[model samples]
Target: MRDDNASPDEPGTSTDRSGLSRRSFLTAAAALGLLPAGGRAFAEDKLLTFEKPRAFSFDLLADQARRMAMQPYIETKSRDPKVLDQIDFDAHWKIKYRPEATLEVADGSAPVRLFHLGRYFQLPVGIHVVDGDKSRELRYDPVVFEMPEDSPARKLPKDIGYAGLRVMAPDQKTDWLAFLGAAYFRSAGELNQYGLSARALAIDVAMPTPEEFPRFTDYYLERSTTPGHELVITCLIDSPRMTGVFRMDVGKHGPVVMDIDSRFFARDKIDRVGLAPLTSMFWFSETDRPDRIDWRPEVHDSDGLALWTGSNERIWRPLNNPPMVRTSSFADRGPKGFGLLQRDRSFANYQDDGVFYEKRPTVWIEPKGDWGAGEVQLVEIPTDDEIHDNIVVYWVSEKPVGRGDEIPLSYRLTWSKDEPHPAEVSTVTATRIGRGGIPGQPRPKGVMKFAIDFDGGYVAKLDRDAKGVEAVVNASRGELSNIECYSVKIGTAWRMTFDIKADDPEPVDLRAYLKSGDQTLTETWLYQFLPEPDSAA
Candidate 1:
């Protein structure tokens, strides 16, 4: 929820250790200069320009990036520091850009609004409006916004430069597209709720070396000539390790989709680089509930990681609140798709109206080319609340991305409530953990019971009484007992029940999936069960 002082971009008020300060992470720079009455730059009606003159392709930008990588990295610095810092959370809300000042970057319903610089975002990015071979820079002006007389933003100077930019509808009522923070961007998905974020690239993430955050230093926002709503964006990315360029074609439908293409250049010897990285929050779910007390049942932006392999296998791994840092990888030749999904969409699960967790969007990434021989890596960090985005997934190529190499990567990002491709196979719906055995019947020595619900597909038409379903359960270091499977009456789903008795205090690796005769009914369910605590002798 946003307070009077917080910026509109704030998703929620969860504290985090993401190293981004409130001003830097939550708000873009928000102060501009006073323009002359004649509009010093040009009239509102001017065509935007690009290096290739409205040519919507990645070849030109990739060539620029490859040339940039041969040079050294240059950091950004603006004239004033105190003025930027003063635009903190509270002060940022006071520096809103006016709706009448939108730039028609495309023929779509959405118009472009530039963000000013504040205390946190001192680096100002240049915003250009492009059409055909014509392009012109959109000049910043302070008089456009309506701020209160006593507001703290009055102390800031004009011409400080804009921190970022956002895209609003033609009516200037709501923002549909936004590019605020470092290499991170998101559109209001089909549900109109912003959930996950997509990054230009990820370098040396989870590596021993300090993670390098590349910035999209400049952006060219172009409007389309055709009446149909279409816009083109060309961006330049820079970091200490590399520099790159990107061109994106954005469309608005039920869910905003971006056809993005980019090329990377390495400044130094590079070993690790993640293409099309996504960042999301995973606090707790049915499988990994928090120990500390809270009013709401669960808190998270996303619930599980869904992957579609090149072999056409669909895999779902429920996110967890691990005691220690964990990273998992699944190797593939050409992955069909992958995404971090917010599956538990029922409002009753959260029961909180303030922050609508049910409306958060799910992001799916579809590779444009054959990203041969790579593993989809998932990195999980321990998070106690919904603030910190502890879950990250990206495609890490098996072949190294080293110095003097230009890597061309392209993909389409889908922001929606469900995965891009629906599956005929059923999926694990719910997971529950409790003490083993009957209530008063001796409590079964060293066992703990687990109930897993699998829904979708032929699970509903299964033999209710004639042919009983089977539970193919296995544990790495435990004795499985009392395994059972039955049809769930509430919906067309099947329930698998089982118990495991560990011989020692060690982690138990468990895997199970339904199989009838020679055919498998669902994706394999994998779980890492930790040792249970002892109570009485």
Candidate 2:
């Protein structure tokens, strides 16, 4: 789940991590000329001072992680839990970082700011600045921030450390990226909205046993030579069962692009370890909407999971808000790529100007090298609203990892409005579900109807009236009938409608694709069907 400064009562609410309100802060900064056009130049008044340098490298960090894993894992406790409790949501908002204290790095390439420790984030992290092969630790100081006179944070120790850190624009007001709460981080993509989050690693997620969240104990921020272009960040992750090192090269061209290199060492055997895991919210969508659930037409950070297999087959699976926890796995060898995509880009589809669901970025995971045999796992947890993130997707290797095993992995993450590598075949545009039965006939108790839309690529060139175009569909445990396919009036898009007669209450797995003669013209569409509560009983 993506952690923000929101209170428990305001779960999933978007918060500005720059320690200030979004609109007022940006407007004021711009008016003062602190933020120039294109958001590239910074004021000369703020500069970062460096302490004595110490030698550092990636190998040294890996060695440190290995040594840490050899010893017993000790959990880091909060120094002042009572003080953090007093600095709750309301008080935390009142505390802000001093503008003059902003750390200007790489000669105004990107400004840096710190997040104060609060109830949601009790464990502090060590932060440092890197220059070439040398680095210096940045100590915590209460004078760097401005808090209300009555704020509980003022009473805390001067060296309490920071909860997290954020990378801001040259203005030091609008932040484009942040790392906070566990090994989790997110970026405001090309559209500048925070939705889904990417975690460093996930251990035993959705298993019978409790899940484990690792912590980023330390961070090293490197100075970039190119102004307003890129930044390098290295993190040391620690947990009870594992220790790891991560290096990320983040570029802010338009859509945020991150190249990640990670290595892990395990203290104990882990059967279920998720690499490059993504977490998002999926409360409701057009496919299955309860009566007047909310005012919005759809509410979700991402609508579908797209996969490109090694054999060159494309697949699209629409997301769901299931009644129970559900796990789906797609096995592959040397897979090309996969990601959770926000395919729907129309504002009318969401009708949410505040959150702008239509602008949520689609994050794609591209492997840097051959990732041997593994399966892409998708876990859907039951959620009544958008507050709780209910969707998680990750890649799990088939080979088991045991204690003392050293695992190295590398991948590139693209946070954009669309998939970086799109399929040449047709694509699934939308999915809709409703009651199954003839319009005038009595409705069937144990039946359902589905309408799937396919557009673009070869399908757009072929005439729908012409023969040979077929809807290849099948169900795992149901009778499929009354199939129909036609072109919609708006564009060259084709719609396929079908009904399923599910005599039993068991869940059904359905797959469909567009084919012309022996050639496949569209990517495969997969969906899961769960019977209504009354019918299931």
Quality of model 1 by C-alpha lDDT: 0.69
lDDT tens readout by residue for model 2, 1-537: 232322212223332111111100010011000111122222222332335668888888899999998999999999999999887656766677766666655456566677778777788998777666777777677776777899999989988987777777665546667777788887777877777778799888888777878879998877544444567889999999999999888888788888899999999999799999888878889998888999899999889999998888999999988887888999999889999999999999998876788888899999989999999999888777766667889999998989998889999998898899988999999999888878999987767889999999878987868678889899998789888888777789988899987766667899999888999989999998877756543
Give the TM-score of each candidate.
Answer: 0.88, 0.91
Give the per-residue lDDT of model 1 (tens digit) for 157-186.
765556677665555555556676677676
| lDDT, model 2, position 57 | 86
Any residue pairs clashing in model 2, and if so which?
none
Listed per candidate, the RMSD to the true structure in angstroms reads 4.4, 5.5
In candidate 2, clashing pairs total 0
